[model samples]
Target: MLVSKKIPWVIKYRPRKIDELVNQDDAKALVKAWLRSWESGKPEKKAALFYGPPGSGKTSMVEAICREYGYQLVEMNASDYRRASDIERVAKVASLQKGLFASKRLILLDEVDGVSGVADEGAIEAILDLIETTKNPVVMTANDPWDVRLRPVRDKSLLVEFKRLTKTEVLNLLKKICLNEKLICDEEALKFIAEKSEGDLRSAINDLEAVAEGAGKITLDLVKQILRARDRVLEPFEVVRNILRSNYVWQAKQNASQTDLAPDELMQWINENLPLQITDPEDLWRAYEALSKADVYMGRIVKSGSWDLLAYATELMSAGVALSIVNDVKSKYRWVKYQFPSKIRLMTQTKEARALRDTIAELIGRQVHASKQKVINYVLPYVRIIFDNNPEMAAKIAVGLNLTDSMVRYLTQRNADAVLNYVRELRKAISEEVKASKPSKTSSGTSPPTKGKGKSTQTKEKEGRGLDAFFKKT
Candidate 1:
């Protein structure tokens, strides 16, 4: 047995008159007056523009007007024709040619705003000129009317603004169509489509078409699938919630790493949300302490270029952290709001200033043959002055040292600024420290300054050298 495709009720029985159209009662009344003027042997505005959000029935209005006034329609999107000659051809045909059966002609321009730039400019200008003097009743539709380029058209035509359809109007229309077509869809499914449409009837119809095509009846699951296709990637919060709600530590770990977040961001999400999930304060502290150790491992991995360490770090933060929790019962948790890490934000702004300061400090430490730490303590104050003038140098140092935004700010010693200033200061301090600690540099340059006594200088310098040697050994 064969079956014929079922036509949707919305399309099978579209309105043919202004009075029959759903919503836009005011626009219908205004269109009615225009029709009456033509009926009584008087010419109203020869051209009118319909401006509104998509699927608000601008095209439908034009067709209704034609049916009411006994006029044949000539419709086209302005974007399709690229040349001035093409538009002129259309204008000539519409103006000179008689309607196939009716006495009058109705020209409908869809998406008139799309006509623009080098290719369509001539064609668009021609159309506007056609509107100014054309004999037919012209109806133009566009999303926006305040576009400065459309100002001339506004001067030449009457503009009617159509609003987005209300929820009640969309619901009523959907209900009417469903009844007429004998389609069986749950109220929730229909309402879901209507809300998702955002007042766009075409979108609603398309959704209806898809659902009907899949099965005779539409279900809520189908609607959810269609609506949420773009959100496939697992969210970190969902992962954490599932983990905290689970009974087994290994299961929780597996669930947490299933999300799209990397180890670092994942750590922050866990840190912020873990306390809310664990009821016991002692358990929460233990979990946090384990996470902190995992973070230390993560830092080591980054510095030493050892990727094998990531698994250990991840395990510590996930399974280890979860085990630290005393209870494993599932329950609701207060949502942790996402926030930018202050340190990261600062790095972005003051990277350059920080780098330069670090470079200079490293060089000074090398020259003195002393420890990087001693050089930083003694030389950073002087280098900070450079930040007042050379912020980029300071920022560069900050980047090299991996200073957080707050640390950057602390380095600059200025609280009232774009936070970038702080980043620059910190970068300089860190880079200088790294350079001073290099293997080739002697311990003498990094040594600390002494008191008024020459003995103090010698003693501090020797202590600085000892510190540098210790760091090198580590």
Candidate 2:
């Protein structure tokens, strides 16, 4: 007798035919068009880059195509091919050859954007080189196609985009999975799970499996217990809506725990949308008063380093602000579209620029032996002035201070390229001077130093001889 193996619902229910995929008609149609283009021996674009949110079926859809069309699927994880040599050694073989068992092959490099840092710059080039020579189709996927690192591949390949599945789509998929598994799952429970997933179908399936494990039936209470304990990256809009709409104190408090946002960040979100939710002036005043108290708690936490105050802060922010809508309770239940905090938006917009400024300050601080703030306010302005006015002088300072190319660029935007080139020339000249002044190789391979120490001092400094001298003195 043979026992059957249990498979994950995600894999077990993966679409084997193109038609099985839902809510992706455009992507499917695009893929099918490309597949048909293969009939002429080659398509206009030899490669396709699929990009979208996770569990949007980027990889699974490719698998379906290969299974349905009788083409062999050769899957490669992007992490593995990090170097040019790694790609050449592995992907090259997969790309140029027909599958041993099938007439055609599809080479998939999954999560191309996840290749990581400057280390994989060569791997990207190698992939481009592979595409030029391969007789087969090369497909890559990423959560973000706009990443600067993927710019080359973006230009070189056909781009196919996928969107996060809708709540309705996820619900239908869950219903189908429950039916197939013959699991007695409550409809409300399934809907709650789908809502929690935020359109991540893969996570929703896994969530369902988790809740159903070792149980004859799944219930709303069971889902709530498990999912609440499992934190997710919740959108501020969802979190604030849930918290503000919650009727009871515990419910509002529980809803606050749904997001992974920092307490202060979440505070900004709540503060921004509070006015939109509470219309009456008196009710709005009450909400703001509670929010201000929460802000007080935050300041205390920062000043006194009392983390225990965080619970009170969270309570005030979530439950306190929420329950303050007592003057006109009907406004609390009204549907209001929320906006992200303008404060947070400005911070986000300036974050990279601030980081660059801080990095430049830190570099300068190392040479000047000053605090980063002091250097930023006092020293950087002068450096910027020198960079703009005196190219040669600026290059010397850049080299002397060991500032990187980006740091120099940060100092002066207009003269960045020229200053960088001058800095490079200075470096080359210094390197050659050091080389020429290294003193021609000695006439003798090994010679006694004509330098500092006397013979007795030298003997004492020598390793094994020190012990002998100690014995002689004794």
Candidate 3:
């Protein structure tokens, strides 16, 4: 039986011809003209650069156009070839080679902006060399052509901008997909996804797929769940701005409920930015008072495990806080860039530092006969001082502890690249050690069955049974 493999919706529904591309008529026309110029032996511009925000169909359009015109597409990402020598070895050869069966070639360098600094030495020069010498047309795609590194490529190529798909265009595409799949989907849900996508058709399609999983019908609630899980949360600044500006309770409540933030996180954001938003002293004081009450409700909810109290907590934080502003002072509130809560930022940093500290303590405790707490309090300070003074010793300790590059950097305050290189060497050594330790097959076709924990396989199985019987009695 031949079972067909299931393809992803993104690939399955992707446009295979240029005309099928949405809201990119100008780009399509420009590309078509550029490709047509190649028939006369050489175009005025040897290459065309397609640049736009991701999921705007830049790469897809170029590929489809090449396929439609029977041109052989040679695709390469900039990340794959970082050095001048790497580019010269692969791209230079590929560019000069003629396609079999009279098919014209098109070399595509995708995400050219990623090649950077020491890694990209001579890469730009090599690409420029190709532009001057290659008979075939070259195409490149990037999210940003205006990026400083891509200037040389931009100068050598004809720039064609791919604009984002309009909301109507995206919604129509979603509706068409739903019809093709024969999946029931709410119109409002589709529209919401389209609007929220902010012109990225690819993201909207992915979101639709996620929401439609394991379901015959797609509901607004299902769409909301997908959006929430994806963290398509309300921007804190926007939410804070609206809350302060809203005069009616329902409007404030609506704004608050729409956000993915819990009451506590939302309260922190408001607490951080409220003073800047409101100029009136009395309004500021009133808002803080409402926040205090919201905190109290949150504490009670925590103590009692009363999830139903969350609604009351949200109301106090949002509507209560909004209504606290005096009537005359309501119009005084103006939107500014909301500052992130410093307390939250500090707490996050502290948490990460504590985790790293605990990891180190645990590693040391395992080697020496002591608790993690004891190692942390009694030994870690001396270890830090030793690591600070001796780089070689630090590297040895890091490998012995099987510590990651990030952990090594945090503890020793060494250069990131040096720490990463050391960690990589340690990992390679460990991998080689494991490979060397594994038993090799004998001259016979079949290898002997392996023992577990120095016991024969059968004996290990018996011990497993005995442990199971012991556990059952307990």
Candidate 4:
């Protein structure tokens, strides 16, 4: 038989068993207890789960246990090798198999915690069935075990938690690997790796490999260079905090936008965290004033198609905010969550109302032989008076204008009574306008209004008619 190919560094270096894994005493004890149950030939635990952060050797330890126990390995990843048929087929064979190569077969389920939805629903059910009936012990691994669906499996299985690697553990591992590889590195380099790894041993090892590749001696400078480039972008939260602590408003403002964050999002970040940064009463007011100005300009740009004006608004928000902080005392800050402006939410609601109102206005204009703009500006404004004087007229106008109760209320000003009255009158006015404006046989023969010379003549005739009508009515 062909020999299995050598595993890659990432896989080969994976921690094989709880005992071999670093810095997880609690998880090791639980695994040992499970293994002891098997070693004693007592009914082996149905399942054992390894759960923790990524690169923490959870999978490696399980594999190591299988190897140490002389058990044949059947490994499947839930992410890729997952399907109802595949799971059922595997379970069927695994259940029937007496042993592999004269050793007991161990089924390893990877990322079982990810099982969910209709796609994996069958797979989950199959696994649950296997857990109940399977002879061979099953080992599953997951980054997070707190998922709701996993609760059943978790309760049935022995749960072992793997924590993030400690700094000391990461450092020791880094040093051990470096020594093995014949690479020379300083304590600072090791610390950098440990710190950058953030308790991820796999990341630390990978980073060390990257730094040590083709190197003579690993210096702190080299480590810094590598670490700096591999670094994640600075969080906008930190930038906001720094700006808040800055003495110079321009400096703080300048740094705020310099962060690789969107200006609009940056504004939100600043706004959310401003209170935390600027604690003084007066300073808070000043900061809000700047924010309000920024918001106004932002609104203007949206309304007017003037994208070029965004910069001024951004600068106003950033710099103006920077000036709002009272003191320049630098201090540590916790992360603050940003929120969307409530006014903006209200404005969005208002826009919907306005659109519906406009549609109604347009329909009314069509029926009344009046422009929509004129109806909206001139006629709707008088709806309240019409409602109080004549309810029938108002109802007719409502039917004519196609006004919804909500829109009528909204256009009727703020109060409920005013809204109802205005709505009634508006409807009546629209209906009357539509009826009066309906072209008579004589009016139907008239030509359309014209521009320039004809417009002037039309204007004069209209004015003269209005004057004569006003005098005659008086």
Candidate 5:
């Protein structure tokens, strides 16, 4: 039997005009102003970055604006944006204004955060270049624009943040889809789907189509039976809720199997919410005991490289910890607001500073002849003290250690430029002294004790060694 293809509801009912967009009046206004500014020959920012959670209308709004406003849209998805050559070519094509009949172009780079690995830096540079030169209005979309690699683009862009839709917003959109399709949908059924979708309009519409495709009437019971969480990727909160709400062991395990998070990451999530979820002391202890066992399993897996043990670890973490609420079943289903794992949050907050600190440690370690960790633990303290108290001496140490601008900034903070200025002066004085020390050409226009390039290279090496020895003594 052949089944006829039909357009997906998300694609068919996509917002085509400005007013059709659900929320984000602020973002829309900013984008409109930015586009208008481009018309006058120069805008404050050449690009706009739209970032938020999925289905928040970043890409959709861009498309809708182009459709209604008469600008031609040139879109690139995640895969297409990785190649720098391709990005350059597209930017070049966008720069073309061949004739009076040519329409203004809008270039959309969707999912800019997904680029990773060796080519990621190059990809970012390409995007930055594209923003600088492209005559067309350039826009980039990301789910999370705060990714450290995207920082360059974020600085150069007009940041417009979109927010997740409210449940009422999702419900209204679903009702509209139901009305357009002429499918009889109960209010309860629509509400149930909207609540499960958690703010994503595309998911809500897709869920609506899933249930109302063949069924003449959509009811609460039918929606419950067919519209399962397994139909889409569940968020972390949804994953936790589903696991804790499970009646049977397999049901709890089933929920764990659906998420994209790794086992350890999921454990952190469960551990964070367990205390809030369970009030009873005994139950809380039991839940943590199960998490501890899962942690042990993970540690063992890491040490032995026995990946076959992952199922046991996952089982202990998800089903084991979830079913620990045996005594007070009510606590398991309590409406406690879950939190992001605090430990991960702390790590994210400190990552850049930690990386910079380690870089300084490496720079000093190379000079002092020690390991990076050793320098961090034993020597960096003294180096920091010198940087804080003495500018001239710190500059000498910086020159000897061969530290970068960022490294110096890490140590001295607001005083970095003062120390760098001293370093520059020291280098200038050293250059003048070296020039005076060099052998001047003889009266016959012949160099003195010179062996061509070999002597020049040896002389440079000798000067470098002398400076290193001089700094070490100082």
Candidate 6:
């Protein structure tokens, strides 16, 4: 019986040492320095944050380092340690205690930036706290370090950036893998795969494995075929051009299905360029009408979790939108450059602002004991007004809520320096007030026991009325 080789090429050929990692010398050096510091009993930085594009050797490098140095790795992905309690249970325990067999422990939080919203409440703060007190070293990896959610974590950890692998480097790695696998691969085939991978070495290797899985030999033609079939393979512009110019419904549908663009994404591209392609106003209206119907189908699919409706959504968006153009004005469509969807562009531009808004909403919900929706709809507008009218009150609220500088600036639409100064002043004042409220020591240098102070009945009623008035403005 011929036993199958089950090990995936990507995993089987993973780098085993620091020197084995490609195009990430700086990252390797930083990680080595961090490890050496631990040996000296004084770490320069307790945590190292690795940020880069995917398929780079961030995770592999950390794992290799831990292996080489005989450190126990307590690894957890974002999904596993999403909540603060989860982090405390796993990471906190790992950090506070010694390893079973290894000399030292390394807490590896992979894709640290993936933690988000309600699920990740207190996660960043928890990580920051861990880095401060953990006897073991902590390491984190993220695709985007500048993510607003990661700002606190970024500040606490030392940042190590991993650059994308060069095309030549990727090509060389593929050749080596092919040689080891004993698959006869042509130079042009390997080069094509490397160029198409766009500096993602892992993807290049996976693609090579896929093409050479059962084939006796790899050729340039096989590489080209695989590249063409890759998902979302068609450029948005070309897909839009074909959808607009094609007369046959089947041809338009085939074009839509062949390319990797999802139905909704294809619709956006078509919607953006349809008017520019079709000169007639009636055709434009009809095209938009088809798109609207397609969106209705999409809504149903989302609500019902029924993927069967996807066919209808695709047909309506593709052929239905294409058929709306009755006039044979192919000549006019040639000169127009396809315009990208403005909505997507706007969303990309305001991503950070939106994240800040959601953060503020969550904070308000916790403080007011209201749902997030209620806080956003009924309370946030008034809070903005209050911030504008009373800076001191706004500063106090910000401090009370533990709002970050970025959050405050985004919500108040103020300068960064101004927000930072205001927050600092408010924090100082709050600290002083707390100091004053504490009982003083007697002549013997011992404080006297006193009755605990609680909110008075009248004070509670007055506060209730104040909140009532606040909501009335909203």
TM-score of each: 0.49, 0.50, 0.50, 0.49, 0.51, 0.51
Candidate 3 structure quality by residue, lDDT tens digits, 204-294: 8898888887887887888998788875557877888787765445557878866777678888988898888877787778888988999
Summarize candidate 5's per-residue lDDT along 173-237 as a digit string, tens digits.
Answer: 98888888788989999999999888988888888888987897999999998876436668998
Residue-level lDDT of model 2, residues 27-130, one tens digit each, is: 88888888888767769888899888878899888898898988798888844665678788878998877789999999888887755332335777888898
Worst ten-residue run, lDDT, model 5? 445-454
Displacement of residue 154 (Cα, Å) in model 2 is 0.7
Candidate 6's displacement at residue 430, Å, is: 96
Worst 10 residues of 3 by lDDT: 465-474
**All candidates in order of lDDT, best leading:** 2, 5, 6, 3, 4, 1
Taken over the whole model, the C-alpha lDDT of each candidate is 0.67, 0.79, 0.75, 0.67, 0.78, 0.76
Q: Which 10 consecutive residues of model 1 have the lowest summed lDDT?
A: 326-335
* lDDT of candidate 6 over 16-53, digit per residue (tens): 98889988989888888888998899987889899887
* Worst window of 10 by summed lDDT in candidate 4: 325-334
Tens digits of per-residue lDDT for model 4, 1-474 = 123223334564666654778888898788878877866777556888889887788877877787777778787775333466777787657865877474687788887754531134566677887788877778889877887767788888888888988899989977877786678889998898899788878778878777876785888899888767765456776677666654343445556655786666667777776776556676688789988898888888888979998978876787677655433222213355544545455657788877876876775565466898898987666775665556545544554344567655554444446546655654455445534655453442263543222224554343333333333333
Off by over 4 Å in 2: 1-5, 116-118, 232-474
Give the Cα-based TM-score of candidate 5 against the true structure: 0.51
The lDDT, on a scale of 0 to 1, for candidate 4 is 0.67
Model 1 spans > 4 angstroms off:
1-10, 116-120, 230-474
Query: Candidates sorted by TM-score, descending order?
Result: 6, 5, 2, 3, 1, 4
